[model samples]
Target chain A: MVERRMPSIRTTRFSALAPLALVAALLLGAPMLRGIGAVQAADGGNTIESVAIDTPDQVRITFRGEFPAAQATAENFRFAEAAAPDAPMALKSVKAEGRVVTLTATQALHPTERYKLEVADPPISRDVTPSPWATLVTLFLSSALINNFVFTRYLGLCIFFGVSKKRDAAVGMGVTFTAVMIFTAMTSWAVDTFALQPLHLGFLQVLVFIGTVAAVVQFLDTMLRKTHPALHRSFGVYLMLITTNCIILAVPLLNAQGKVSMLEALVLALGSGLGFALALFLMSCAREKMELARVPKAFEGLPIAFALAGLFALAFMGFSGLDFFR
Target chain B: MSETTERPPGALQLLFNGIVSENPVFRLALSLCPAVAVTTTVANGFILGVAVLAVQVLSSLTVAIARGVIHPRVRIPVYTIIIAVWVSAIDMALAAFVPALYAQVGLYIKLIVAFAIIISRLEVFASRQPLVPSFWDAVGMGLGFMIALMVIGALREVLGAGSFFGIVLFKTKPLLFFALPAGGFFSIALLMAFFNALERKLTGGTAKPAAGGHHG
Candidate 1:
């Protein structure tokens, strides 16, 4: 039998080295190098300058500013074009970087187009204002339901399936995930906006987010174990699991990318959390019935689960037709 | 001499185990979340497979080597931290290097740390086995997972979008459902049924009962 064979040292070394060599090759591969170039080009360009174009055929303008305050309204920022100052081009997208705002116009600018953008007034100071309490509500609703992390963006799914074996467990995991997501998002947002973005520590986002998530999950586990023993017993095991959950770590990083306000981040977190809950809940319900369905011997468990999830994904796609919000 | 004589399985056996017998996604049922989420496109599926393969292989190797020194009580957390470090490294490298694929995969890359496949293999196989055997097992398992993802992704992409890896394979309008949550569920179900049938036929109608045989 092959079992009686003593594997040669050369074979052992070759087997181990094979994968490492493959990984090295992939890392240094040509596609990866080209991709890096593209990223650099994409991130390249002006940091803080505004451009306005006003032509007979079209009018457009673009500018950047710091993070918008809570009460900062679209109406406050004004734009004027050579064609019509009062009827300036409509705002297309508002992308912000710290205090610099990059506003794009819907219509293209004419050949000799020129336009102007002004802040009109400084946003309410963060210290003076209540940190846009309403923004938090909006952010929560948007992130938790509307722009859900799991169903919508499909982040942190590895954990979604792992902890969602039972309905109760799924709900418990969802709650824990939401709590951790909000906590991590907020903390990372602060660190990114304050420390990383300011001091060029952007490279630290991944390290910081992962560290924060691991730390937060640990803290929560310890606190729950000490304070609510029964609750901990139910959710404790799943708590440690959250440290590796991508949604908890990824949402904050994404939130920072979108340059969302604190309130907006909360809404994003809530929406994502609810989305995950929705997906897991539906999955658990389906799996419950799936337990009895005469699945093939090979497709008995996880394979069937994956197929079932495919169906669920199909159903969730129905929401794509919802045009209530762009 | 008894222990030395009891050498664990060979490399070929380990490799075959991952490909067919104990497939991470289909056979063992580990790491289904990314399997479902990233299978929207063949390219996505392929890239995800590579990412997961790298993480699983490295994490498994690391865990296997340190299994003896790490205390049992703190083992889980230690395993997680190690996995997280690799995941973070991968995440940053991808973001910095391949922004397009990075954007498409997005948070799914970071979530590799939480994938049960890596932890499952680490605990069940890698921890007990020697380094060479552990490495082969990881490869086999990783290949199994990649195959599963590709199958689902190809089906979804072809039927849902009339494309494979973004290339237009057909001009027909896609069955929009095939691309959505409902489609994901239905596809897995049908595929599972098919796989079961295949297994039954392949084994001459006498495959061994599934592990932890749940009737459901």
Candidate 2:
């Protein structure tokens, strides 16, 4: 009887095709370069006009084609008193046309005072609304606490789980992660808004964002390693992990999509990072206690940790009803 | 009776291990991030479940076949690269073919790369096992993950949205938090408590009593 040989053709074909597939990906990815170029061109020369309103009451303002019509209905659109910079007057009513918008105010206008009309991006369909400086302050506070990134949005779970095993490490990692998130968000916003948007490079958003995060994390790691040895030891592992943390990646993309101003972007990044840190701190404390507790064989490590996280998440839900910032 | 006379466990054993005995989410508690994040709606859960299943199976196969050739020092990076490539391919494919689901899942489609479950399996079972056993193990674990996600998603959707898979099952006010981040926590906690209870009941007092510390 002749010895039968099994067909090795499938395995051979798979091995042969793998390199070809990679080559094809590279070739197809070439369009990404042109796309990025388009994004850059579009965002580079985009000019924004900041109009200071001196009126204390609501003012009806209209715009023409120069503004993206979507800005007429932005949620962050507000009127502030020129005399009292802290008390922002809300827009009573707003109406918009192809290029013009009419704003009506409920309060009286103060003569020769400098008030600002601000608009946040998501609620707005257009990009032309003049966002107020106060909106930036609010965004910072809200993003950092009320609408925190990690505790609320649950981004960066992997790093939160791994490095947060100890309280001190968690605090250090949280602060470092927040700092990295802010830096990464700022760079990504600049790149996306200035370089990519004008060039129609939206398709490269994910690739670019991931690359930016990885580079930022690596740079931060190198800097920390050289500057503060003890601090570096505490955050070194978590710093490397931040490369893949989604909050760092997600915030910049969200900023671009939301079309927020530079100030607004910074505030949002700070808030998100702070929120992440807060969540990590709480989780670490809980997990530390869990370490000493007697756990069943089946529910020892990851399982119990997850269950605890779930409860913490539920506790954080109470903030949703506090519509102070919304 | 010699111990060597006992028969080794079969493929069915491997399959059962993944589905129930060693279920990824509830039992092993692996892949909790995606399990919790995507379980807001039934559709999201189903889509995520499929993504996890595909990544787990393909990555397991690759890791098992190349286990001996790859150096242990570089194993993590290699595994991550493999998973990232597959995840990106899935993300693009979804963007092209299933645009609606892609939009709903959004950036999370790319997050599949970071899910610990896929990497954990690669490190634990797939690396040491043969291709056939690894394949069955992946299927079992994948199914286990799918079931857990679907359960959580269904519960959340029904309670939070007052619907299941977008269909209004009853005319009632929804618990909005059930759809938000908080609901993600509450639902998972309750599910875990239920799992603990089930584990105790199934083992018929054979398993050791869970220590108080483990009770989340």
Candidate 3:
């Protein structure tokens, strides 16, 4: 009786929880690579928060903290392409307005190309620029990264831990979860905006969001069963299960206060979905590797998987200092 | 035939059951995410546990009282609606009165709508039992869950931060891993084993394995 037995981890059943937080970090970080210059600006009060390329000729840099406008020299900020580092874009003039630094490029930038705006490590001053677009965009963008349900909020844990045993299944479940999230997010936003807000029945959000999710899942289930039986048989269980995933419910609830616009809701859902999928894939791959190793009897099954998730979260913490543009 | 009929446990027994025998975290292995996420600190875990326990008791009582009227065919939805109502009410109140606590556990409170533990009790016991019995059942289960969470939280806080309930216990450097989510996993596992060992020493043996994993 004292001898321990390992809970089976090889069953292609499902991942236990979502890990796409890194995937979210990556997806959100994609925009960062384009501004790889700001990505490298570590969190020592020297970080750059926002950069605007209104015209390729002139770019505006906004700092989250204080940066002296007078100290802004031409060499302080170097612009680059695809972040090749070797090939730097020459600047025509450097102008600083408190925390806002405006750089005029010597050459016109390709409109389609993503530019990497590098800032040298120094005390960055908080310059205020009124780019409503940047502020709105980053607010929406960071939710996908910092506010992600799985990594940050720890939602969708049951599915993440259960279904992540197989990479393909995890990917499938993640995609289905993301699709449901986008639709549910949009529908919930509409309901909150039109019905709940005017009536002051904000407390009904949990019921409203859960109802929306359940109704969506049931509708999708019926439509799939009738229209595409084969596909339904393949992924229908996953579709139905998304209704129970906390991440999906959490998304709408977080946006229930009408703090984010409808577009931001959609973006956050998509980013969160992708992040969840990424975490699932990473976890499945790692769990698959566990098959070859001998695990202790006591720490087998959910225990070890959770331990791994903790490690995954810690690793994601490496990106803690990384903010939207910074 | 006479030996097969088991005597049902009393109200206190039901509550005691949640603490050890059928601990939602350690034994039943249900609703683990909140257990892991909120256990980073003792205060965090206790607050979440309180929220969940309150929701569970109210929802269970409601379910027990409404059991006869709910259609079996659509029972799942009805139960869901009941739980969601209670959870939402708590969610709103927390945000309004205890903004700081709400800021920390609001997501968890909202997410309680999806917890298998609360819904499972409604389905398994409350729906079939009398109102008084169901209420006791839920209270027992709630206390069990709260106790389990606090035990995990206290352990994590002490080992991770070298403190207990925010008080420093020693001068040693704390183990950082205990504070991380991984620490949550490890702490839960070891604690499960420890709890099981203690349970065995007391009661003869009816222990389910540690992390009696139940999939959604």
Candidate 4:
């Protein structure tokens, strides 16, 4: 029965996506348009929050203040090795993220050595423009592309492989999964913040999180059935499958573990959902095309698909070293 | 109506079935995520496999014992709760006793409740079988999963990182690609194909394994 209706339904869905694509383009561009005002309103003074070693060769200095966009010269900051105060550490590059600045040293610093950081007289650039939105955008992009749930984290392979046999089903599943992810992420974060943390019921995190995801999916299932019968029929099975999908549950657990703010959690959820969708779409397209070009018997079904996913993972690995805000 | 009249496969056969013929990772293709994700290192893979084994056996045992009492309508959720309780117990235990392993695999520990392998066994094998057979089945499945993970983990560590069980085999890694997530996918793909080919040859093309399905 579903096979008979698939062709017509797919065509209609494609047509429907055109307007959505346009709206998505405009919405995505909306943030860049607002960037003109993104130069933050800098307050009079700034103070250092904390200094921590981010990497073997890098130290991150977080500030409880904002500044305008300006040159963050190495000389503006001072790093002294406690053992050799006279011979200061050399800074190679300095990147700023409004409230956070990461300094890369020319040489790797010993993990055991104590280092002291001092904001020089000219401090981080007075021209440093503060932008909270940029931080959120960076977070979203990093989570979606750099640390993708499917490619990098390996969170949702079951659904990724199961529903990716066909392109239309993949797209439908991606969209449905994204919506459910965003909704569940928000609900789980809220519940953690409001109920679990306050009541000291953190031990029940797994139980509560899985329960919450199940309830939300069940609710979405019924609501979609009643409101949009056509949509439900297409997405009903995927919805049920998503209740136990690792990605759905992982997003909330990650958010809670990271202790990210509500806004950050939402962005993470959105990023992860879109990332998974992107992976699904790409894999489905390749699989649909590969239907004609199989050679080996043993590497026919999942083996081939997995090999393809490995290629995609390699491709996505390129995004790890990218620094957009820098 | 003696016990001898009711014949079933011996416990040894059940164990063998799980480890080879019906291996969870190779045959059923269930729970492939952790099979690939944590297997980058031998220790990570072994620890997660052990944790999963513990959870699988306990959940299967519980379902087998209480199968009659659990309502048909609410069985799925009941199975989930049972799995969750055991997973939570293991999660806390690892954290308290083995904090290092806990830190590396803490998130995945919680995710054991979502693994299709455990729940599927509970629903299919445990829910119907009596206590003793179910216990054997669980043990076989658990050991099969653990052994599979260890093999994969050892492969990745040796080929990717130039190490075996955290001991350096050489000064340099053989192929850095196998250490990355992409390499994980490739290794698993190759292993899956290899297993399939071996199975086909050994069975003289008479037997065919079931296709992979929805997993968490």
For all candidates in order, state the fraction of native interface contacts they contain: 0.43, 0.18, 0.51, 0.75
lDDT string for model 3 (B71-144, tens) is 89999999999999998888877789888877877778888899989999998888877777788889888888
Which residue runs of candidate 3 sit more than 4 Å off their true CA positions? A1-148, B1-8, B171-176, B196-208, B211-216
Q: Number of the top candidate by lDDT? A: 4
Worst 10 residues of 1 chain A by lDDT: A35-44
Give a tens-digit lDDT track for model 1, residues B1-216. Answer: 132357799999988989888876656656656766777788888888888888788888998788778887887667767777777777787778778888888667777776777877877877777788889998988888888889999999999999987889889788887776556656766776676677788889786533321110
| Per-residue lDDT over B1-216 for candidate 2, one digit per residue giving the tens place of the 0 to 100 score | 132354435678978888877777666555556666788899899887887788889989988898888898988767877777677767777789888887877667676666767777888777777788788888877778888889999999999998988899988888888887767866876777667767778987565422222100
Q: Using lDDT as the measure, name the better of candidate 3 and candidate 4.
A: 4
Q: Give the 10-residue window scoring lowest on summed lDDT in candidate 2 chain B.
A: B207-216
Model 2 in CAPRI terms: which quality?
A: incorrect
Query: Which stretches of model 4 miss by more than 4 angstroms?
Result: A1-130, B1-8
Write down the C-alpha DockQ for each prediction: 0.26, 0.17, 0.49, 0.71
- Candidate 4 lDDT score at position A32: 58
Winner on TM-score between 1 and 3 is: 3
lDDT of 2 by residue, A221-307 (tens): 888778755556555766776766667777887888798878788878876876787788899999999888997655555556766
Q: What is candidate 3's CA lDDT for residue A195?
A: 95
lDDT of each: 0.64, 0.67, 0.74, 0.82
Candidate 2 vs candidate 4, lDDT winner: 4
lDDT of 1 by residue, A52-141 (tens): 222222212222334454524456556556345566557655554455454555665432223444444542111011113223433444
| Ten-residue stretch with the least lDDT total in model 3 chain A | A1-10
Give each model a TM-score.
0.67, 0.66, 0.74, 0.81
Interface RMSD of each: 5.4, 6.1, 2.4, 1.2
Query: How far is A260's C-alpha from truth in model 4 (Å)?
Result: 1.6
lDDT of 3 by residue, A96-122 (tens): 777788888888754334665656657
